[model samples]
Target: MSRIVLRHQEKRMIWSASSNYNLQPFKIELEQNVPRMLQQVKETDLLGTFHLAGPDAGITLEQLQSLRSQWLSDFDWNKDQAILNKFHHFTAKIETLAIHFIHEKSDRPDAIPLILNHGWPGSFLEFVPVINDLTQAAKASTGQDVSFDVVVPSLPGFAFSSAPPLNWTIDDTARIFNTLMTKVLGYSEYAVHGTDWGSGVAYSLYDNFNTSVRATHLTMAPFLPATPVQLAEMNITLSAEEQFEEDEAMNWNAQGNGYFIEQTTKPNTLGLALYDNPVGSDPRAGTPPSVIDHNEILKEVSLYVLTKSFLTSIYIYWQNPNGFKSSYTKAHTDAPLLFSAFKYNIAFWPAALLQKVGNLVYYRNHDFGGHFAGLDNPPALISDLREIVVYWK
Candidate 1:
């Protein structure tokens, strides 16, 4: 017999004090570093903004004062934490790390499990609107049994979840999440919803475990762009819709992708720079107040700053620089794929491209939403998600 050597390791799981496997009471403990962060933000001298170069054109001195004033006077972390605690929160030890997730189940027994994953510059808060809608949709007296058991997790190295092992990649994240659903929480099948980095994870779930991952709802396609030869081989042509998306993608690649390049190549450098600074912004000014609630942005900044994982969160970029574009391009899965092409999204795959990607069962061209579909337009997102159940069987 040939010699067989197998290296094995053991893991211990520490769970919350819930016995029902579905209900748990948890609280988010804010770190004591908020004061120091506040001090830094308060002491920000636009003395530099005057002599600042073009790249430093972030929030203006006036905007900085606004954020500072709000941070001091209006922002309340406890109240927001309580709001998050309204949903059932739990932690599962996947390996040596603790995975933090909000598991909100529909009251009805037949409710389907749907996992929501957030991306960069976003937190679990992105899906709160959708979660609230889905949780309440079935309970109303409307005689509709349409809802989901939503699971929103803090991606490894973000807000609540601990930093993944330094060498971990998105494939590892997908595998661990599979174990979380099946082995830990006891679900054999589930659907996934994601945006940005989370979109990559959702695709992997559907791709790697078809039996477990029944469907996927995503805002972005993680596949690499088709080569000229491949595009010619596939005889691809653009529709009016695709041309618009193409223009958006091109414009984004040209104008909005500096952060992408920096995060992928030198995350540590930029991460170190922004670790303590809460006012990080682009080379532009005057952000859209309508797209994201300023308070919501404050919450995101507070979470990143308080947890001290602002730098580690960017590790996702280093882990999957192309957001799994190379690996996913060759992937073809039986799992039903759904794409919500939000109009102002940074990049979008055309219907033709989506059809070539997976079993694209449902496609929506949302006119009002942006890159952050869940946050930008919850009603549309909720309706589309509910309709996904129609294609489930």
Candidate 2:
């Protein structure tokens, strides 16, 4: 049986020959790779519950031990793998890297082209439910056959996308995605939605190539002004939601920033370690796991292990240590901007932030959902997106 291969060389050509990027393609070869039960917990010293805030902020040494035991003994990997592969997957070479993405096309004639970007600790899987629900809505609402020709690309160094050979920043990523939309997919104008790191990419597109992007939506807004007049003009009022976001950002900065620091400074070292033992230990070792909540260790490991896409994902952080900083300095876009603030996200201040940024034609502070809104509440997310697109249209 011949195996399917996605091309990457063509995309890499867009970069100048002087660019120092390098990529190597490798296939996963498994022999009797099946999920097995984790070993029983042996570390008894670390057992008990740990809290992210309030009086019970830190976990006892014993709780860490117990958490490790449970993580090692429980959690199924094979189940996770089956769930991840449900969507149609394909890869394209962008420059010197292989880019993996999920393309779900709606049969509707007037389907709008939209690119959805996911952030760190998130794969293309994050947008699956949103895509499914929105596509269905398009079929029902606009009998005119309105649908979204969706493209969910794995960020370079995550999932199926190839890693960068040298340090590439968010601008580099935006350029590559722009090519993907204009050259590879052949879309003249498209809508873009992004969350977390994705928001940075979406903002870049709007700033650099506003003509190509019809509209842009972001789940996280990280821009802030240096003056008060700019804030007042933007109608920057601190609602309860906005206050909460500020508080959370402060808290995370104080107690839960080790991961970010590590990723920004020594991503390569950590990436190699994670690649070797994607599911070896509890990812919640030093801090309270809830604060930095992620899927179980087994699930995270499964994502990297089965796909062998660990290095690819890590390379994004490794190459673009200053990506976030660079994104902050980029000019604001005059295009229509939509901001969605999840209830539990403390780092978001929708009303005030949007007012200060630019023309926030649409803004919603969702009463539910969190950082991973698409995954946590797909139905609400889909409805919000549909309504916003309709209003803009």
Candidate 3:
């Protein structure tokens, strides 16, 4: 009801100005709303969402046609909604904002408490791949502490979460989420894993609350393009794989920068057009620079459509240029940090540079997968996350 009531107020305060986080079970009436939204999609001017021709097109006339056909004939809202209900969902009001999250605890005492955050064009859904793996490992670990009690949140302004306030930044986000983990969940100390926009929040959590925020893991980091002068001075060496990844990241900046520029400068313009159509948000919204399979892409689009959270999802770009800032130049913590770079990711920073930011303990390079490693290469992300256990305790 709250989500429906707060339609598209870019600058309006959507929640009560209080910290009354009365946890409520999340339930959506997809049966009642899906048909109406689908009708809007049928009447949508999708031709505008696309502009390119030939090989490099945005969503494409063909992709748009395919999405409509799949929505009408193949998509199953009931089955998909049932799958979502399988997980534990909860929402609470925090700092005049409503926060939605998944809190699933492992039965085993050996499990450690962990929080996972998602990025823009993305929601809490990105972390679904590793949910059962992390939560169920507690049962399989038998004699050891291998699994985790996972807490994954829909970052404010995305999915079931509320659109952030007018001046809300990622650091503001970090503060509220820290409250969620420590004050709401009653966790004394915890570890965090993040990707895309999430990596910024994860880093902020590690920086602001070193005591409760124990260890940090990221698939992306603070990476900048290596200039010729800097490369020569540092004697930068890249393996063949690293060289390919560097080229891919640079190419993405050239080709994919439009989405970034529009969302950051004029998010409301696009958000308004897509407000009625849930396909307004697509699986591609959450993905990195890779060709996602049709089925995988459809599943993500369906979730946002059914939940009616797509419009608010794009608000992240407008809410915070930097998520939860923490730049005490003289301050540094020995909190163990672990990072992994997928071959096709948008950016990759050298380990030496990562050390300048925080305590660097583990780093690795994957031969396969891209930016959405959690979805594209779950096994590798799982193994990489498990790698953190070595230094966690």
Candidate 4:
């Protein structure tokens, strides 16, 4: 395990907390950072490879060339920055860290306060496409208008947010975010939604701050994947579609988890090596173009490069390598728990496996969409959230 030791003076300067902790307006600025990123992209030398085929083989040379070419010519960071700036961005000092978040309020006075969280290799950009939709009123199945005061925060150590202290887990994040919602933002209670690592924080928020957290929704769970032996012992049968999803998960465990191992055990080595390397910092691939287009993928890589926080962003894995070790049966919460399981997500947990996670009130298995639900299928994600928020206590 790597340790970040700060001197007393350094700790005083870095860990300084604001007396008022006011919310200050923030904007995405990349004037100086963009040119540096461009220069790095231009200077990259593609490594020769002779390996296996398919996703298991990792990114192909052609894909790297295409991404580099796009970053140089077609991809415009300014335009993407402007698009991101369209939303209302703000930052507030919470305890020891300054948190950057998008606080888009609905016009309706009765709009529910909701916080959307993103995970590793993802920034606040994941919710950009759906924030506007989430703020507007949607007609629910019961003919009632459903709108939300949407807040999306960059996780600690992510782009635009300060790095967390050593050994800071998602539970620590949940504590700070609960304060962001109830104390700083002055929301008495708020709904919660998360995917990937965000789901772990959401679960903690739901479990610990149940008084302030009204309801919770998740596209992913933090529990360990159930084994074939466990499923067989339980006599749980899988549908043909589910069997495919299972096979996909098995493949990911075998081939796609290299980054996880690196991040979990040797974050310091990997993070420093890839500090100025944008191509090396790109997020997960293998999603179809229809789910997340090439430009969108580049946008994420650009954020990591411009902010220079790829190192900090990966520290969560090191801080809590066993975050997913909890069993589904052990995760208990009284709040209304809704899970939207997309078929193509990295791991698929049927309702049967997830029902034990909490007081599950609503569970939907979407035939489409993947890990990045908001980017993959905004309409379905929006629809699912709007429909499920009605069941909030």
Residue-by-residue lDDT tens digits, candidate 3, 95-192: 78889899887765556678998875666767777888887663221234577878999888776788777787777888999888776776667899
Between candidates 1 and 4, the lDDT winner: 4
All-Cα superposition RMSD per candidate: 7.6, 8.4, 8.6, 8.4
Task: Flag the better candidate by lDDT, 1 or 2.
Answer: 1
- Candidate with better TM-score, 1 vs 4: 4
TM-scores for every predicted model:
0.83, 0.72, 0.83, 0.89
Q: Report the CA-based lDDT of candidate 1 relative to the real structure.
A: 0.71
Candidate 4 ranges beyond 4 A from true positions: 1-19, 48-55, 274-291, 329-332
lDDT of 2 by residue, 198-310 (tens): 88788788778877787888877545322334445756657665566566655655665566577777766666644212111123322321222334434555556555666
Question: Candidate 1, which ten residues in sequence have the lowest lDDT sum?
Answer: 2-11
lDDT string, candidate 1, 173-288, tens digits = 88878877766666667788887888878888878888888888888877754443455577877667656666666666666677778889889887875522322222121243
Q: Determine which window of 10 residues in candidate 2 has minimal summed lDDT.
A: 1-10
lDDT by candidate, in order shown: 0.71, 0.60, 0.70, 0.79
What is the lDDT for 33 in model 4? 83
Candidate 2 versus truth, CA RMSD in Å, comes to 8.4
lDDT: the better of candidates 2 and 4: 4
TM-score: the better of candidates 1 and 2: 1
